[model samples]
Target: MKPQLLPRKSPRQARSKALVTAILDATAQVLVERGYAGSSTNLIASRAGVSIGSVYQYFPNKDSLIAALRERHATDLYDTLDAVLTRRNPQSLEEKLSAIVHGWMLAHQLEPDLHRVVEQEFPFFERAHQDQIPIYRTIVERVRQLLEEHREQLLPDNLDLATWMVLQTIESLIHAATTTTPLPVHQPAAIEQQIVEMLTRYLQVVNPR
Candidate 1:
């Protein structure tokens, strides 16, 4: 049997969307201020200036609310990355890698708190969360494509390994940059350049003159 789908929203859907957004925004504020243990549906409702029943009408429980918020945060990050990657055309390998790293760092800076909530508090809704394998796969595929286009300059038989290494290294750098305490002494551009340099050294196949 086919699975049942949820009903489509009508004109009232706009209002519902706005209400849900308000609740999620309020929830984020509360979560950052008081942590997970202190944030409750009642508090979210009060802060959102909506009825408690209204909050329940949208989110059945705290876990559901948080799961939705996590999804939203991920979608927003992806959208920003997409825009940056779409707009840039780097003339050289170094320029391309720098663009990618800078784009990622900018996205992280744009939503550090949301990223923190997802990375730190998202485990509570493990079952609700989706796998990020596709995200990593896409990054690797893009790197591989770029490498292939520059085969004359850097021909590596193991493109898969190169792509994986670059993706993993950049991912770890961003995660560390976002989570580190007391923050690092270096500026954002310095950090981005550092990541770009490290990845380029590992992935770039040197051609002996």
Candidate 2:
């Protein structure tokens, strides 16, 4: 059977929530500094200043802790996407694209080291679309709504395919820009502008005056 990745139980009270948060925070730190091989439940417990038993109280093993961290990270990304996609004021397609690209990059930058570790050390962390990976689908559907709202300005007849391509392009490029080194331009605004322009041109977005 596959290793148990889910937590043993969810934290209920305030103290329990705090304990769980500490464990997850420590897990992120260890994963970033030590990579997967070196990150053990013992090490994570020590980092969190908790006992091994306390760590195992919620998580069965390192895999479970990692899985929880992945969920937390996905939630953070979803929150960022929601912030842009659910704006009260209306925005042009290019404006929305810029907001999402910038917001997504900012969210990743908030934990760049941990992000790199998650993506590199545990490749499965980002394998979305299955029932286990609902965040990817959630994000895709949110973008689809945005596209539907601007259907008149959009060029693609198939919104689903266009949404997939748009997300792939942004995600692939942003991951490359953040994870890889020695990029030609390091200014985030410049990179975001380029991404927005690329998407806008691809979508054939026409903003009416």
Candidate 3:
């Protein structure tokens, strides 16, 4: 078990809220324009037009700031997943999976470089904010149910392992697609189809076990 990196407190008032928003917005630009090494509190404050003290008021350190950014990203992705779950197509697992995949895809596309920086440059950030990762458990649970419901269409046993693979496959591929340099062509429709096709086929037992 690890402690979650977090801000000192959340913004409550309208003015303070605006300041936090500006700070985070500026943080994103700094992260994009400058790598993690260059994204210092002074630089972020200067970019945000707020005093460096204001930054410290909300975030204790650079790591905390980065963690908050990661938290924001996680929230967006989870919200997208929640929205997809609300109207998931019951008859078509592909449609349901596609919605989840595309929702997360859009979330990553919101800040690709920052996402890369969080994942590649400071992988520890993920560990620091491990608290937020469980939001994704809903996806895995839903997937497990899908596996059980379609047991005849899928393998008899190992539904748990299959579910993990399906979740990881979508997550890893999309993360690579968004973060890799000399990035692969991101034809949304084609990518979605390929993901759905691969996942569907993998779950489908051609030779029954």
Candidate 4:
């Protein structure tokens, strides 16, 4: 149909903004209930109590609408990480790692249904969301910087590689634990502790030299 990328035009007024919000929320609901393919713009408009024209005003097709949902979720994750990174570190890096574990877990758990549906309906690890690479890379770089600051605590190797590895470890596990059927780890607290231990040992300052 149409190239489903950016919105046709951003909402400028309060009423239009609210309508867009409703449309997005409706789309999320539809995705959860009917999965990705069933989340059509017409169906979303109906659930949003709006006209098909209104949905088309913002999103050209289901692809654009789903992209919006994907961006929204990514924003939530970055915002959560920002909150932790902005705070003063009054605790050990291990404790901060634990906070991050908790933050990501809670963030995904915030929309478990949507998350599961997205995983099932979209090829997130593939080309569909390739446009989001820079967004993810920026976050990875932020984490890399954080790790570099604690270079003394990490193995004296390529810090960039180490940060990337750590990120993949955490992301892969979180994705599995949250979206997979019969989760890879069911005990939330235990899993959190395990991750903390894993990262803690991996990044500990062994030699000051």
- Which candidate number maximizes lDDT? 2
Candidate achieving higher lDDT, 3 or 4: 3
Worst ten in a row by lDDT for model 4: 123-132
lDDT of each: 0.69, 0.81, 0.76, 0.75
* TM agreement with the true structure for every prediction: 0.73, 0.87, 0.80, 0.84
List candidate 1 stretches off by more than 4 Å. 1-12, 125-164, 182-186, 206-209
Instruction: Give model 1's TM-score versus the native structure.
Output: 0.73
> For model 2, how big is the CA root-mean-square deviation?
2.6
Q: Candidate 4 residues 89-121, lDDT tens each? A: 525556667777777776777788888787677
Instruction: Return the TM-score for candidate 4, rounded to 2 decimals.
Output: 0.84
**Candidate 1: 10-residue stretch with minimal lDDT:** 2-11
Candidate 1 vs candidate 3, TM-score winner: 3
Q: Per-residue alpha-carbon lDDT of model 1 for 124-165, expressed as tens digits? A: 555223443345445556767877776666645677777666
lDDT for model 4, on a 0 to 1 scale? 0.75
When sorted by lDDT, best at the front, the candidate numbers are 2, 3, 4, 1
Clashing pairs in 4: none
C-alpha lDDT (0 to 100) for residue 173 of candidate 4? 76
Task: Indicate the residue-level lDDT of 79 in model 2.
Answer: 91
